[model samples]
Target: MKNIAILTLGLRHNYGGILQAAALYNFLKREGYNPVLLRKYPVQKGWKAIIIKALEILPFQNLKGFRNSYIKYINNIQFFDEYMPNQTKIMTYKSQIEEFLNKYEIDAIVVGSDQVWRYTYINDTEYDTYFLNFKLNREIKKISYAASFGIDTWEAPSENLNIKKYLSDFNAVSVRESSGQEICKKDFGKYDVELVLDPTLLIDQSFYLDMIKNKSPKNYDCITYILDENTEKKELVKKINVECQHKSVFNLLTKSSKLSVQDWVASFKSTDFIITDSFHGMVFSIIFNKDFLVIINKDRGADRFYSLCKILGLESRLVTPDSVAIDRMAPIDYSKVNEILDQLRVKSKQFLINSILE
Candidate 1:
């Protein structure tokens, strides 16, 4: 079997990040490739590393800085322990990445399925490692599958040339959003980019169905999976629950619920309705054929939601906080959505196969 190394945002405490990484890994495994997640640790050294270690050791429960850092660490540990055990190996430096590439004899490196390409996400660094900045042999394939820019547009005047140069080296490139395709063409002058489904969507619903099979159901009428905790969004969910009698709303991520990734999938599968601003939340709701209302999250890449909804013919389901009159809205016609997904699934699978096999 050919060895494949997936470079993604696996260390994030977010459900979408973890699940998408799993989805791509699982998909590659099913395709008969030996896939491993490249766990790239931050290149903290000397005083910086020592400071972090000190903070970790210090029991400053009263200090918000120490408390928040501790919580983040705990959450990351929990995610890796429960969901991604034995799937990852560490690469702490650029030399380590190069060493790993040679050590594993990896056939290809797939960068992907998230906002890994976004400058802000990479601490505003130019020529992020996600763009495959490392030196490598010319023959080894570099593919970008469902990689997203996370915004409709970007203004990286200084990095434009570098972006184009790095992206030019890819054997194949596919983006998660239509806007991404546009950006590649307009910004980088790369017209050959293919717009493909997120890795989360590329997998069959049955894949997720199996993961959630034996889990107990959540006792709620609606599940709200909003990433942003704005009062307007919160109040809209509350209004919907109150107006739609017998429908109790449960907020998921905002409350920092201790539900594992699998547990979250099960809860989403079992919920009667979904109220979400999260892209993956909207995705799962559609995949499971549940009734859902998408709140527009302008700050968090709302373009992705719009593009996907438009493709699936469910743009009507996307609404602003001001448009939360649930009684007036019609149920989603998922028959049409399923048909679109069926067609896109074939196309996305072909893209993956061609990117890997060709």
Candidate 2:
């Protein structure tokens, strides 16, 4: 089996990040390849080592400083272990990716299913890492699966030429958003990029339900997952619970989430409805087939939601905080939505097959 190295954004407390990585890794393993998740950041040294020492007293594993919160962190770490079975022990960031790949003897590298290609999110110095711009000792297949620009429009960086050069080396490229296809051709001159589903959607909902089957998730009439919460959102959710008689409600925040990864997936199981400004929150709501409304998190990028809704024929679900009319909204017609997804899966899986095989 080929040793496939999967690269994406850092795998931390974010539910979407972990799930996407797991989905791709698991999908590849099922396809009969040895897949490994690669976390950026190798063993720290120099100034980074000093910063680590300074933050050591705060919390690493034990309940020394933040006793009440440290245990929750440990649970999250355990969640990481459960989802990612085959991952590198130590991570290497930026240009060091070349050495890390060599050390592992990776046969191929797969970049993304997240905002990995969103130029603004990447650092100026390390753009090479995400773009796969490295001088390797041996030639290995480099590809991107559902890599996203995060937004609809393109804003070329100063090093556009370098990006084009890097992509020229890629064996295959697929993007999460259709807009990325235009950006690739218009801005980067990479004309052959294919639009595909996010890695999370590559797997079926039963798999997620099975992971949380026995976790005993709490039932909520409405679950709110707002990444950038404000008074407007708080008041809206409060009114929603009061007006709709949603007695059991919960706020799922990854930053302060105490739930395990499996537990997090379980939280979606019992919720009748979902209110979120996050892309993945919207995704899970659809996966669970729950009635939902989305408040676009503009800062995070709204194009992803638009692209998804357009694909699933659920564009009406997208609503703004000010323009929301709860009474006027209608239930999503998932029968048609599911039909579209089922057909898209075939095309997407074919893209992967062609990309991986010669």
Candidate 3:
């Protein structure tokens, strides 16, 4: 068995980060590799640093602060592993990283499942720069597996120079979206880039179902929305839910609503339709074969949904705030969606598995 240090996003409460890490971890274990998960830290001390310690409890603004701090700290970031709430419980973290590097006497380290490298998520930490220059040390092989810059745009020239310095460390790299690939090419001037699916998509529906032990949702027709972006506004969601045909509508913004990602996914599978502004909101709907309308989110890069939709050939279903008629999204071609997923599944497996084997 090879000792693999797999770094992934650790914020488990976040759907995309958690599920992507789960997919990669499960796959790596199946491949007979002992993978050690790492959580990236931006600030090392102070009560203010406590923000990341209780990220879920902190307000959205503070979460943004941690994200920004992380970007500044780690440059060649990959995957971040989510630790349990208590820090002492994960005392072996550094030791595990060192052990994995020395023990199975393995081949390489893998980073990513999502936007682990995007500077917006990194804060003020020198680790951000040195981690990318890790290659120059030449002690171990480094690879980025389906890592995302996460955003659709490029940084200014000065920042690009900082980014370019660290990107030189990767032995191979792949990104989750075309937009991110474009940024890598433009900013880092790296031509060797492959497109890989988000790790959530890397695994099949059965993988998720297996996690829940034969669970199913309440059969009622429901409309589930996780309001991460524009759709969070009360008026917009109320307007859509008021007009939709579904009997029950649920929003994550409510205090009483404590649904986990799988809970949300299960609900998506049973729902007749979905209207969402979140990226994973669209992902689960498509995975479960639910008819859904993606709201254009100007804040979180609206192009994200459209880019995924375009890749799947489902662009006609996109909805805007003024569009006002989600009822029109009915009767999506489930067969067409399956066909696209089938192709993507093959591509995803080839990209991830072959890259590892190579």
Candidate 4:
């Protein structure tokens, strides 16, 4: 079997990131490839390491409180084990990556879908503004799978020349959205930049359906609100709630102070409609065949939603940040979105399978 290394950002928790990675891995497996995950850093080790990382994650928790809360959170989730690297004894980040790679028997490396290529996502530096430019021996097939820069738009300088040069190392390259594709083309020139489905879109809806339990409470009509760290989203969600007065609105941040990626997906699926600013919010809405609105956040990265909507012929749902009147938007025809989804799913599966065979 072909051993493929899957590299991504935030495998431990971020719902959109994890789901996209999961979908890609699942699709790669379906196409007859053994996918191995390779994270940027190693999982924390020992009580001290765990405590340090937990403290790092928590915004305002004392060391003991963070540790206890983290352990409890870890125990409750099923996918936590698979999400993070198994670093029971390992101490360093470099050692962890090497150990994981050696144990998993990775033959090829596939980096991306999330912000795997962006240095800005990891650190704050001039280099961080560019793509990762670590020196590597070019022997194995290097592929990028729908990787994103995570910025709404960017224009790097001469200092980031190496970052643009690094793209040449990859055998194949794909980005999550059209804006990403444009950036790649503009910066690196045309080098096989294709728009692949997000990892969440790579898997079928049935997989998620089988995993979630106790799905909706009674015949209650629910609406999901997936927002970024944008204040405009709060206003739009309020408008949507007012428009859909009869039904209850479930804003993810408000409903659960602590929520998992799977929990978000489950909640989104249980809803009759999903209303939000998050790209994956719109993604799950499409996957579960729910009517949704993409509240465009111009400051944040909302192009992914608009790109997917355009691809799937759900153009009507794309609402600008200035669109205060939620009631003015037209109701979506989910059946048409399904038709586009079915065709894209087939094409996306074939693209990967065909590439592997070649």
Candidate 5:
């Protein structure tokens, strides 16, 4: 079996990021390959290095903070053990990452399924790493699977000429959004890139249902998975509550959220309705066949939401928070949605198989 190393976003608090990376790892393992999710952080240098060290030892990083951080870190490791068992040691510095990759002997590297290529998220300091443009001790196949540029536009810190030089290393390329295909050709001068499903959607919903099967998720008629909560969102939830009356609106990013990753999946399964601004939230809503209303959020990469929904024929589900209030309890016909999803899943998996085997 090929020893594949995944180069997506690091294991972190974001539910979607963790799930997508785990999904990719599971998918590869099921395909009879050894897949590992590399744990990494952006390299720090100069004043940034000084500040990071300072923050590590200062009043904010007191015994209390140390205890909390330790707990969170251990919990994260345990979660990965259950889902993605083959993981590298946490590497916060460039040297650590280089040493591990060299020693581990990865046969191929997959760079994506998240906003890994988003310039604002990664910035200039880590462009080469995210692009899989690093120099390794040995040659290995480099490819991007459903990698996203976050948005449709070109916003990388480097010029297209320089980016093309780095991107040329990839043996094959696949993007999560349709917009990324155009950007691949126009900005990076790479054509024939395949557009594929997000890693989360590549797997079956039964797998996710199994995640919550033991959790005994609480019953709720409605829930809001708002990524960016605001007055408008609060008001919208209030309106939805009038119809649902079991409003359990919570931002998983919030410090107060004790909802585990598996619990979040369960929430999607238990709820009858979903109102969300997040791209993955909508993805899960569709995956679980729940009625949903999407908040138009260009700031959060609406292109991802648009591309997936457009192909699945769920355009009517999208609504701006400012739109005239409509009936939130209307049923969504997911018959065609499931059909389109099944068809896409086949092609998406085939793309990965060809990308790997070719």
Candidate 6:
């Protein structure tokens, strides 16, 4: 079996990041390839990091800061220790990453299934790394599977130049959205870029269902997985809860209480309906055949929602809080949705197979 190293966002407090990384790993493994997540620690050496470190050591760290950090640490522990036990140890520097790749005898490096190419998450100097900049043997394949830009537009002229140069090295390039395909063509002049499904969507619903099969179900009429705590969105959920007075509403976005990945899946599975501003939240809802509404999150890139809904022919599902009455909308007829997904799944699977094998 060929060994593949996947470079993605670090295992952080975010549920989507952790789950997508695991999805790619699991998908490759099921295809008879050995896939391991390359754990890259964030570079924390700016004034912000300095100030945080000083606060911690001076015994005067504010209670709010301490509490937030503790919660993040606990989330990381649960994700790394329990969910992703086979992930590589922390690789802090570029040299460490190169050494680990060589030591593992990795045949290919896949940067993907998340915002690995998102400029905001990375420093300017490290742009090439996401493009697989490091030296490797000529026979080693360099590929990107469902890599996302997280936004519709490209960076500055100089940045685009650098991106174009680095991206030219890839053996295969696949993006997560249609907007990403346009960007690749316009910015990098890479017209052959394949628009692939997100790693989570690449895997079947059965993969997630198996994990929560042994767990007990929770009682909830609605699950609101709002990532952006917008006042209007929260109020909408509240209004819906009051209207459905007979059933209980569960808010899965509690700040202090972070649920395990399995618990997150179970929450969605057990709920009668879902209302969310998260991309992944909307995705799982559709996959599970649950009726849901997507509140466009402009700040966090609404292109993802637009692209996905357009492809799946669920554009009506994406709406503002005030535009539609949650209760009045008819139940989603998933026949069309499922048919579209079936075709997409076949194309996406073939893309992955061709990217890796040929």
Off by over 4 Å in 4: 42-77, 82-104, 124-138, 213-220, 229-232, 328-330
- Whichever of 4 and 5 has more lDDT, that candidate is 5
Q: What is the Cα-based lDDT of residue 289 in candidate 6? A: 93
Q: Model 5, which residues run further than 4 Å from truth?
A: 45-74, 243-255
- Over 128-207, each residue of candidate 3 has an lDDT whose tens digit, in order, gives 43233441323666777777665687644566766666667666777777887888888778778887777777778887
Of the two candidates 1 and 3, the one with more favorable TM-score, higher being better, is: 1
For 278-307, candidate 1 gives per-residue lDDT tens digits of 999998898789988899998878888988
TM-score of 6: 0.90
Report every candidate's CA lDDT. 0.79, 0.79, 0.63, 0.63, 0.80, 0.79
Candidate 6 local lDDT, 113-135, one digit each (tens): 77777777665346667778876
Q: For all the candidates, what are their Cα RMSDs to the real structure? A: 2.8, 3.3, 6.1, 4.6, 3.2, 2.7
What's model 1's TM-score?
Answer: 0.90
Which 10-residue span in candidate 3 carries the lowest summed lDDT?
83-92
Clashing pairs in 2: 41-91, 41-92, 41-93, 42-91, 42-92
TM-score of each: 0.90, 0.89, 0.79, 0.80, 0.89, 0.90
How many collisions per candidate?
A: 0, 5, 24, 5, 0, 0
Q: Is candidate 3 or candidate 6 better by lDDT?
A: 6
How do the residues 1-358 of candidate 2 rate in per-residue lDDT, one tens digit apiece?
8889888876655778778888888788878989888777323468966755455445544333343244544566666677667777655555467777877778889999899988777534465788788778888899999999898876566777888899999999999988899888888899999888888888888779778878887787888888888887777766666766778888887455567778777887788888899998888888888888788788888999999899898888787767555553567888998899888888888898778787
Better of 1 and 5 by lDDT: 5
Colliding residue pairs in candidate 4: 20-199, 20-200, 113-146, 113-147, 120-128
- How far residue 18's Cα lies from its native spot in candidate 1, in Å, is 0.3
Writing each residue's lDDT as its tens digit, candidate 4 over 139-199 gives 4566676777666455454534565667776567777778788777776674578777777
Look at candidate 6 and give me any clashing residue pairs.
Answer: none
